[model samples]
Target chain A: MNWALTLWRLASFAVAAGLIALWQLIANLKLVSPVFLPGPDRAWAALMRGFSNGTLLDKTIGTLEHMFYGWLVASVVGIALGAMIGSSRAMRSYVAPSLEFLRPLPVSAIIPVAIALFGLTQGMALFVIAFGAIWPMLLATVHGFGAVEPRLYEVARSLHMSRLAVIFKIALPSASPDIISGMRLSLTVSLILAVVCEILAGLDGLGHWVLLSARAFRSADLFAGVILLGVIGYVTALAMSMIEQRLLRWRTSGH
Target chain B: MTSIALRKDIPSAELEKSQIAFSHVTLDLGGKTIIENVSLDVKPGEFLCIIGASGCGKTTALRLAAGLYQPTSGHVSFDGEPMRAPRRDVAIVFQDYGKALLPWRTAAGNVALALETIGMPKAQRPARIDELLKKVGLPNHAAKYPAEMSGGMQQRLQIARCLAQEPKALLMDEPFGALDAMTRQGLQDEVLSLLDASKATVIFVTHDLEEAIYLGDRVVGLLPHPGRIGIDLPINLPRPRDQLTTRENPEFLRLRRELFDFIKASEA
Candidate 1:
């Protein structure tokens, strides 16, 4: 089993390397115009130049701050509201229909409304990002809290736990697995919305960098921004999984 | 007939002395009658076992006593007060130990949940947690998660957590029903010994007739289809019962046979 897992991981790395090589070959053959598609070498050079001159670093930090703030707001509100709605049948019945109507509406469609409300600034981007990211977390929390083992509630009651105590000690911990997965989804949404908002609002982030580079016909710089965004997404996802592993260590350690 | 009349007259005074009492309790769930006009009284420190066929509301009765569920009519009282909600001094040991225990917590952590709920000082929790874990024979296994432990061990940890409540009354709903025979017997003895030290009033519910006879000072059998008591018997077996000798004892055998017949009849 261990050998099989190692083999699969190796195979995944090989596939990625193969794709990169294919991309480079296409560039060398001029299958697409250089203005349209830059080679990996050119993209790498652009990346190095941007980082060395501190341009990419600033943009990266800006994008990260936008994503982080948006995600944090979404998380706090999502979990709190979810706990309230999920733990009570009456609350669920009263609020779930309105949520359902709102949840399926495209988040991108709300960008104009956000822009109107906050005026094409960082606040507009933040609002759009949080709006897009909140759903997954909120729904996940509601589902998780609602699905707690009924026996545990009985145990809680038998122990004479208060409402707050039950929520914190029993419901919160029980719902954490669902909540964490939701946060992961919400985080991905946060990043995507952050970049979209930045691009549309003409803000100082990777999204704006990519947009400006394209307008200036600097294909290499545009490709560099795209590659950096990919890296950021990959790294953040990896970090989330690491945090998940730590928080849910008991689940995997022996069972 | 006169002696039977006298026996009926004795219950009024007995109800006053009882630690836990159910007076004509009826429970209806989702339009179906679950328990119908069931009345019972358990003396302080007495080990009372309730036995019946499946769907006989034995578990419902235990839940009522635990204050997990309220009767649709009549009342359940603990120490002369109406049981409106679960009391800290009444701890329940559920049948599904896996579900009853918090899977994310270590054995010691699960025990600490009870202490924390009751507002025990954080500074004093470790010693109390250690004492409770040790009491349930999980001294070395305190750091183990519930998932890491065996079924028997998890059940023991559940017991340990319940004991941490320092309960005056323990309500068990087929607690050892999921374990292997050997493990079940081991837990039964462990519980008996624990009760010997605590002298807590106990209400044990199970379908196992021999278990009822072996453990209880008295046994009540319930009839199904809107459950009510069928037969009530007092066990005359000696205390500190040995597994082998108690099974061999004539009185134990007789009570076991009586209970077996009662269950068979109730089922029919």
Candidate 2:
């Protein structure tokens, strides 16, 4: 009887499981053609086969590598530019209009430009991912830096702390929470851009595999790839949340 | 022993001279004059309080004393030299304690900011931090962050951080204004004992008339609309003043009545 409370905590996953069971029941009754819509068992079998044959592992690694490089480059450039622009009113005013003009251009729209510049290679994929991820990180960092309490600046100045020390200690730490949230947003964006670039370029990644399977009429393989991508997205987001919690333990650990 | 021997080499009369002096200082902010030709003298080891209404520019004057702002016309000096910028020897305690201390840093980490600015060796900081926290009656609260402490405790931590600088003069801008009555009285007595032991010159700004009389060797009443001194009264209340007894003293009552009348008339 006490297990009722425990089952309530697992309600989300239990609902997902129930939906999958219903899907299997409908497919078994042939309510729709299995050719167009296969049961969960077909997708699971395809997933297991792909993993055992090492194709899924290789493609996942390729996707992860592309995402990491692009995220890293974006983070470095975003943080540096954000700090400079946010700290100076003149710089912010000068660059803000140009950034605003370009920010609304969609990532899919930029694919042709990226393809022309770097071709269908890893470089092309990196360019696409970095281009897509940088905006959120840069805006978040600028806002974070701008929102620092003015009194903290006075405290540092009155103490006669050196210029570099003030920036590193007070400015950076004060802006970190906002900056971390921005990075989390950029992480999900990077995952999305990586897959999109992979599909557009026909490169070696989950996106390319999913596309190829769908074209060849292997619905189970396409479904399996989609499920794998979902898991990867969920796990990476979970990892980012862990890092954020660790960094912001000071805020949440006590009153 | 070395410092004592070194101190004896300088003339004691030079040490006893006015530590901070504002000579006809006028400050203009955004095309409007905020402080107009105000002159004041803070002698060595003196406790002077500036009491005024909200628009009287008392906080601006305190900032000037801290060398965080420079006068438009005359000179604000320390050790007879004009102050150009904030010096390590002059520390400031602000009223908004929540914004002043770093939220991410623990109480000890906040105090360590002053010590680090002075470039004390890393190995020597822990003991000095413990001593400073103990002095502020916050020995056990060292690991607690500013958000975790009450207003009074956070203010005490701020005071401890300022003390870490070992400044020759302190500029406090209504430090106890945010605390409750009992907490304010306790902190006032603690500040008196701390100043007594250190012999540091202090310029305490407050809107509270009784606080000005209770704490200051002299109370400078400022008139609003471009702040300037209106009444300069010496408080002859005895040392080691008690909260109940000092408030009940005749001279204290007299000074309070005078400052109260001055504030009322300045607003009118």
Candidate 3:
């Protein structure tokens, strides 16, 4: 379509390719061991091997499934709890201290406890990821619900809306933009947690794939796994942006 | 005492007054009184606009009348019953239209919201929504979300939505204040025309003196902190009044000037 944008994209790709070429040259000259700097071609072959053998793909799906479940659990629970706490002064005061205390405790810090309690099971992994992801989302949902225009609530009242009708029709939609923003933030955190859990907890995921390759000195596979995780992370984040665009299209154009 | 007297005088007036009311309406936000010793006698099929400076609690007065807030001292009765929460016979069009609508729904979906709120049958809502869309000149924009709309169009949809409740009265809080000049006047005319067609009792709140004068069958000026009636000015202009002539007319100009001087005097 637009030549300027097309050319810029092409140039950026070329620059990326050039950087890879330089890495290949350094590895070939023995400037660095292949253990640390496997060339792109070698990495490509390893990626093919993993894909052909189905190990990489399987781990990828496992990682995604964890991300999916973790994000879902966290988002749903966070939104509901956040709304409850945010709307009620009593609930907010009761829960605010605990949430503030726990939100800062790193996901890594909790893994040992999770492992000891749940013993490296899916439950442990899901809990760790969900725990971290839910915090930001819960706060967002609370704020979103709190920020709902009072006038709209009056609209519900004047229309003689049932309590459920007001919540579903007015309250949820009113607070959705802020809540979605929270979910977007939480999703990245969830993905990061999934990978960290896979690596430290010996779980079935891409993080484990990377760790295994590195220990065995399978340099190419290790590099491929890291690169694959990067792509997945980038795509996942972009997908969230697209979803927000579609969902809040009303807010965008309204007078 | 007066309420009982009025009710007995007119057999249908309670049903008429059940449309909306405010009496000795004292409102306390936290512990501070916002509206006090306020009273109004509104009939069905009439338009009343409240005008005042910011923080005057003119809006609060409407809220009290709508049963959005409980008066600290006086009682607000709707249709001869003590007002509680919001009623289905009255609908509000907010100053901030964006805040009123759901971001996920289309214009018609937003309009259909009120009907759904009142538990209208689902099977019949679509046709009602379509009728509203056509009435508001948004027949083709039913599926268009609020975000896709221009300010005037969004307000139009809001008006249509308020009407969908088939309310006996409409409550608006500076609904056109945020629009550009051209759009504001256009919406004002459109709103007036719609009110004329429906004969729906309307309680519109605005800070604009011109808008208050132009739209109201009577303009009630209010003062702040403890909101009280500053002036109760009536417009006796003939029906289906024109904007240009009415604005330039001697009676309209005199009332506008008197109200303008009244606010200035109050501030002084």
lDDT (0 to 1) per candidate = 0.90, 0.88, 0.82
For residues A1-255, what per-residue lDDT tens digits would candidate 2 score against the true structure?
Answer: 879978886997889999999999988898988776678999999999999999988988888888888998888898878888887789999999999988898989999998999999899888889889999889987898899899988888888988779877887788889888888899889999989988989889899998998898888889888998899889989999999998886677566
What is candidate 3's lDDT per residue for B1-268, written digit by digit as tens? 0111111122464434444567677778888888889888777766888998788897788777777778888788766778787778777888888777765788878887877876789999999999988877799999998888888888899889989888877888889988998888777777777776676778999989988887787899998777889999887765455667768889888888988998887676
Q: After superposition, which runs of candidate 2 have C-alpha atoms over 4 Å from their true positions?
A: A1-8, B1-16
DockQ (C-alpha) of model 1? 0.67
**Residue pairs clashing, model 2:** none
Q: Every prediction's TM-score for the first chain?
A: 0.96, 0.94, 0.93
> Could you tell me every candidate's TM-score relative to the true structure?
0.94, 0.93, 0.87
**Who wins the TM-score comparison?**
1
The list of candidate 3 runs beyond 4 A from truth reads B1-21, B28-34, B52-56, B179-185, B206-214, B223-226, B230-234, B244-268
Model 3 iRMSD vs. native: 2.6
For residues B1-268, could you state the per-residue lDDT of candidate 1 as single tens digits? Answer: 0111101113456546999999999999999999999999998778899999999999999999999899999999999999999999999998999899999999999999998988899999999998888878899998889989999999999988888888989999999998999988888888888887777889999988899988888999999998999999988887677688888999988888888888887777
Model 3's CAPRI class is medium
Clashing pairs for predicted structure model 3, backbone only: A250-B147, A253-B147, A254-B147, B18-B79
Residues A100-169, candidate 1: write the lDDT tens digits.
9989999989999988899989999888888889999999999999899998988888887889989999
Write model 2 residue lDDT over B80-170, tens digit each, in one string: 9989998888989999999999989999999999999999999999999999999889999999988889999999999999999999998
Clashing residue pairs in candidate 1 are none
Ranking by TM-score: 1, 2, 3
Which ranges of candidate 1 are over 4 A from the true structure? Answer: B1-16
Cα lDDT for residue A46, model 2? 91
